[model samples]
Target: MRATLMYSAGDVRVENVPDPVIKHPTDALVRITASCVCGSDLWPYASMKPEDGPARMGHEFIGIVEDTGSEVTTVKRGDLVVAPFAISDNTCEFCREGLHTSCAHAQANFWDGEAEEGGQAEAVRVPLADGTLVKLPVAPDSALIPSLLTLSDVFGTGYHAAVAGGVNERTRVTVIGDGAVGLLGVLSAKRLGAEQIILMGRHQARTDLGREFGATEVVSARGDEGIAQVRELTGGHGTHVVLECVGNMPAYQQATGIVRPGGVISRVGVPQYEEAPIGFGSLFRHNIRLAGGPAPVRAYIEELMPDILNGTIEPGKVFDTTTNLDGVPAGYQDMADRKSLKVLVKN
Candidate 1:
């Protein structure tokens, strides 16, 4: 088997690795059919120190069940399934409350102390199979593969931001960032009936897709200028809600700056900073609320599956580049260089 490994920043390679096998009663061995590079994966690919040895890369994947441990019963051989980025025992208290990302036994599939668990490979060992894997009603058509794959992470994450921001029929929303997640955030807001959607992005191609995804306005400005653009569009009152999908300090600042006094800022971008100011003067003075974290993708998969299966939403359009397992490194480079919105790897 071959898998992707990051030896250091700007160095991603697909090399032969050991195949996976069921190691726990709750585990399942899946033969990956499709996988992709995530923006979060780029964080490490860009700045990881040389001393940090190669680490397995990738989390979003869809596949066919090859084998299952004795305790796995929800899925069987030949069933097509998707694995959320985080593996969780869905029976835990947090999972029961619809927060699978915080499950008591939660573990990132890509960091299971072994390289064989990565999604960007020939196969992976999925722990908590009964709880972490969502079985498709039937084997998906090739055209539906990318869309189903997004449900494993980005789409669910975007949906999380929208739900947390309280987007509704009367709400006016602004989504920061036009990455795959940001574009999906626009889509989620539209599906939830947001009255207005403003997307803050500089790329013409992505901003165009943002419009197709339901962004009523695209603000190409940055820094204070961007803030002014959003405010001007909102009648100087700022938006009723803000979705922060970039996870950078500047993007966070923009989110807090353009939200109305009583509005909420829902963030789902993988935070790159260690600390941020959220004191009284920054948030309490305006009565603004902040919410969001790693999306409980497993919790939302079932809810979003129908729309994806029926073709009502095409979040898969985010995958602007496609490649084979061997081309993953180039795929990463294309995304890191802003030449592509997202990359999908067909194994």
Candidate 2:
């Protein structure tokens, strides 16, 4: 079998590797049908840091179950499943409280474990299969493949952030990025009944998609100017909810600068590191709520899956390009260089 390997930061290659087998009683070996690159993957792919040799590169996928352990009862060998990026047992205390991402048995393989079984490869050995993989009610059509694949990450994640931020019918929300996750944040806000969706971005294609997703206003602001523009649009009061999609210092400040005193700032961006400083005093003075983290995608997948299946939400629109598993390195490059919004790999 051929799989993607990351020798080090800024180095990714396609190499022939041994296939994965079920190693745990709760594990399932999945034959990946489709997988996609994530913005988070670009962090290690373009940086200078130590990474696992031959580490798998992707996490969002929709695949057919090739085999499952005797304990796996939610799905069978032939079922098509959307596997979330994080593995969880779904029965843990945190999982029961809708925090599956923090489940006691949750596991994420992008940085460790079997490097050959990440979502970017031809196949993956899914841990906690019964809880980590969501079985679709029917076999998805080819055209719906991208949307189904998104259920594994971006779509559900974005929805979780928006909901956590309390974007309601009367809320005027400001979204702080233009990535696929950011675009989906706009959609999630709209679906949650936000009346005025303000999307901050400069890319025409991404901005256009933001509008389609439900952005009532588009702000092409980059730095201080962008923050001022957001204030002006809200009568100097700022928005009611701010969605921080970029996991960088600049975007973090932008999110804090443009929300009302009592507003909620929900951040879903996967931070590369946790060394940055946040103004706790300012947050307390303004009575703002700062809430966000890796999305508990499983908690929302069941509810969001039906919408994706019915064509009510087009999360697949985020997948701007596709490539074979062998071109995984190029996919990372394109996404990092802003050459593509998202790319899918056919496994």
Candidate 3:
């Protein structure tokens, strides 16, 4: 089988690799049908050094069950399933409480934790099979596959940002970034009934899609200017919630600057920095709340799939490009170079 690996900065390869087999009682072998490149993958694409060569790539995937371990019962061979980016035993205390990302099971982990397996390949070995893979009623060739695939990460992540920020009918929202997650965050906020949605991004194509998703306005400025634009839209009060989807220092600062004194800043973007302002002047004094982390998408998959099935929202539109395993290396480059919002891989 062929799989994607990042050899170093700007170097991604799809090379032949050994096939995966069920290795644990709770494991299942899935033959991947669809997968995609995530914006977070760009962090490593730009800075990964030679020493980190050959890291297995990809996490979000929808596949057909080829085999299952003796203990796996929720799915069977031929079942179409979507695997969340993180591996978890859904019965764990944290998982039961809707925090599947913090599953306490001894074998729980992210796709990268298993060095040999990656979703951007012919197949994958999914751990905690029963808890990690959700069966989809749609067929493998369903038109909804791309939309259904988003349930694995981006869509669920955007939904988490809205839910954690406590978006409601009366809340005003500012979604930072125009990548897949940010665009979907706009969709999620609209779904949650936010009346006013402001999307902060310079990309006209993506922001247009954001408008289709539910953004009432688009702010392309940065720093103080961008902050001023958002404030002006909300009567100089800023929005009730800030969905920081860029995961960069500037995006974080922008969230702080445009969030109302009593509002919340939800960060679904994976933070690139360790130290940030949480002191009186930044968050404490204003009584602003901070929320969001690795979205336990496994917990939200079931709750969010119905809308996709009903065609109420088209989050998969974020995937502006498509390729197969052979083109994944170039797909990574396209995304890193901002030539693609997201790339879908079909195998």
Candidate 4:
């Protein structure tokens, strides 16, 4: 089997690796049909120290079950399924409460020291198979694969942000960032019935997609100027909710500054900073509520699958580039350089 490994910053390689075998009763072995590079993958690609050694990469995939452990009854061999980025035991209290990301026995695919299960590979070992894997009604067509794959991570993540931000028919929402997750945030806001969706993004291509995804307005300005534009659009009141999809200090500041008093800032971006200003003068003075974390993708998969299957949503538009497993490094570079929105790897 061949898999992607990050030796250090700017160094991603697809190399031969050991094939996966089920190691737990709750596990399933999947032959990956499709996978992709995530925006979060770029964080390590840019800053990982040279001495850190290589690490497995990728966490979004849709595949066919090759085999399953004794305890995995929900799916069988030849079943098509989507694996969420995080592995979780659906029986846990948190999972029962719809917070699978915080499940007591949860573990992230690649980040949990499991090299055999990284999505950017020929196959993967999915633990908690009955809970973590969602079976598609039928094997998807090549055209539907990318959309189904997004349910494993990006789309679910953006949906989580919108849900946390309390997007509803009466709310005015502003989404920050225009990456795959951010653009999906626009779609999620629309699905959740937000009255107005304001997207803050600089890229013309992405903002254009944001509009297609239901962004009522696009603000290309940055820093204070961006804040002014959003404020002006909202009649000096700011928006009722802010979805922060870019995990950066400046984006966080923009989110905090443009949300109206009593509004919520739901952030799904992997935070790059150790601390942020959430004190009385920053978020408290305005009575703003901060929410969000790694998305409970498994929890939302079943809920969102119907929309994807029924064509009510088309979040896969984010995947602008497609490549084979060997082309993953270039896919990573394309996304890191902002030359592509997202890359789909067809194995």
Q: Per-residue CA lDDT of candidate 2, range 17-83, in tens?
A: 7788988888898888898889888777766456345466778888899999879999999998888
State model 4's lDDT.
0.90
- Model-by-model lDDT, in order? 0.89, 0.85, 0.95, 0.90
CA RMSD (A), model 4: 1.3
TM-score of each: 0.97, 0.95, 0.99, 0.97
Worst 10 residues of 2 by lDDT: 106-115
Best prediction by lDDT: 3
- Sort all candidates by lDDT, best to worst: 3, 4, 1, 2
TM-score for model 4? Answer: 0.97
Candidate 1: worst-modelled 10 consecutive residues by lDDT: 106-115
Sorted by TM-score, highest first, which candidate order results?
3, 4, 1, 2
Candidate 1, lDDT over the whole model: 0.89
- Using TM-score, give the best candidate's number: 3
- In candidate 4, what are the lDDT values of residues 232-335, reduced to their tens digit? 99999899999999999999999988999999999999998989999997799989999999999888888898898888888999999999999999999999
Clashes of 1: 0
Candidate 2 residue spans exceeding 4 A from truth: 48-52, 106-116, 273-277
lDDT of 3 by residue, 1-347 (tens): 88899999999999889899889989999999999999999999999999988899999999999999999999999999999999999999999999999999998898866788889999999989999999999999999999999999999999999999999999999999999999999999999999999999999999999999999999999999999999999999899999999999999999999999899999999999999998998999989999999999999998899999999888899999999999998899899889999999999
